[model samples]
Target chain A: GQQVMQIPQYQHVQEGEDFTTYCNSSTTLSNIQWYKQRPGGHPVFLIQLVKSGEVKKQKRLTFQFGEAKKNSSLHITATQTTDVGTYFCAAHGGTSYGKLTFGQGTILTVHP
Target chain B: EPEVTQTPSHQVTQMGQEVILRCVPISNHLYFYWYRQILGQKVEFLVSFYNNEISEKSEIFDDQFSVERPDGSNFTLKIRSTKLEDSAMYFCASSAAVLAKNIQYFGAGTRLSVL
Candidate 1:
């Protein structure tokens, strides 16, 4: 079985603060993806990391894939109330036709 | 942007009753998938359908669960018998391809409550 483990299950920060969440997979992954689920909303795809040691940025968000492709992290800068949501990391292995194993998620709560 | 649409935002049934969750993926997308998430838990993969057949499934997708494309525009998940443990949010997702880098668009989800 494949497992994606995410840390800091819950995080609360005031506006203008920074936050980061990390994910580790028990087995090597071919690629990893980041998604955000707003309160009572579905998960929305944010970005995907494939190449080893790759890093991608989306506005105030930065995503990094470990060299081994077994871990990754998502960092949010200067959090805002709009950033309140659960961030999840999903992984795809070498096999399987793009089936994803998702992490429990890091729930972010920002206070104004 | 196009989105995946799932019917019946919520479903409540008895422990041994049969239930079906329906999904209509983006018209142009070729890959369809089903996932489940218990309250405050990770989203778990149940099955992946492509070219009208299942390409992958997790251990959680046992004999009790089945999937079908049904027609040109719909993908469905049928639970032969429900259980208290089966109560969760079921999401339908679609992707353009099986590649690692493609994005998967998810539906709002159908919250199942088995009593």
Candidate 2:
């Protein structure tokens, strides 16, 4: 069985502060996708990382996939109140399509 | 952007009763899947459907649970004799294809509470 683990299950930060969440997998993944779910809302797709050592950015957020393809990270710079939500990392294993194994997720709370 | 839509955002049913959750996946998508999340827990994969058949399913998707693509536009998940443990939010997702390169789009999800 494959397992994806995320660090800092929960985080509380003030506006203008930086936050990061790490995800590690027991098995190598073909691709990793990031999603954000607001309180009492459904999960929304954010970005996906495919190549090893790949880095992608979306404005204030940066995502990185480790060289080993077994880990990934999401960093938010100067977090805003709108950034408050649970960030989830889901991994798709080699040859496993349309199926995703999700981590426990990191809940980010930003205070103004 | 096209999005998946789920019916009955919230459902409450009595034990031993059968319940059906419906979803309309994005048009032009060929793959569909179902996942569940219990309160305060991680999202768990339940089953994946393609070509009118199940491609993969987790241990959680047992005989008690079944899925069907009744038509070209609708997908349904039926639970026979619901139990209290069945209380959770069920999400319907669809992707353009069952490939590692494609991304899945998820629906708002249906919250089911079995008493």
Candidate 3:
């Protein structure tokens, strides 16, 4: 079975602080997707990385995919209270079709 | 903006009882999935449904678990004999395109508690 491991299971950051979370998969992935789940809410899609060694940004958030396509990272600059949530990296196209293997997730807590 | 809808936001059942979690995916979506999350634990994938059949399933989906598209608008997951470990939040997700490239929209989830 393929496994996706995430680092810094929990993060506590003050307002305007920067935060970064890393994710690694046991197997290479064709594409990796990032999702955020706010407190007491469902997971919402954020962004997806498809190419090897690709970098994409959404406002203050930056996402990077490793050259091998087996690792990824998400960095947030100047965190805000609304950034408090659990971030998960989901992988697809390793050995299954129409299926996604999600990492354990990194919970981010931004304090004002 | 379409959303996946789930019924019975919470369910309480005795051990060994049967339970069914229902979901209504986005109208134009073609792929469906079921995942579960224990309190304070990671989300675990259960199964993926496509083309009126199961395309993939995790080891956790055994004979005790079954999924069915009973109608044009309904997808159901049935647990034959529930156990304490089955207590968790079950989420139903759907995507408009092939999974590898499409994003899945998840429901609020159904919290199942087995006493």
> Model-by-model lDDT, in order?
0.94, 0.94, 0.92
Query: Could you give the DockQ of candidate 3?
Result: 0.76
* Cα deviation of A8, candidate 2, in Å: 1.1
TM-scores for every candidate against the unseen true structure: 0.97, 0.99, 0.97
CAPRI category for model 3: medium
Colliding residue pairs in candidate 1: none
What's the best-to-worst order under DockQ? 1, 2, 3
Q: Which residue pairs come into collision in candidate 3?
A: none
How much lDDT does candidate 2 score? Answer: 0.94
Off by over 4 Å in 3: none
- Residue range B1-115, candidate 2, lDDT tens digits: 7899999999999999999999999999999999999998889999999999999999999999999999999999999989999999999999997778888899999999999
Give DockQ: model 2. Answer: 0.83
Q: Report fnat for all candidates as fractions from 0 to 1.
A: 0.91, 0.80, 0.80
For model 1, give the interface RMSD.
0.9
Residue A10, model 3: lDDT of 98
lDDT of 3 by residue, B1-115 (tens): 7899998899999999999999999999989999999988888899999989999899999999999999999999999999999999999999887746888899999999999
Q: What is the alpha-carbon RMSD of candidate 3 to the true structure?
A: 1.0
TM-score of chain A of each: 0.97, 0.97, 0.96
- The alpha-carbon lDDT assigned to residue A33 of candidate 1 equals 93
Q: Give me the overall lDDT of model 3.
A: 0.92
Candidate 1: which docking quality band? high
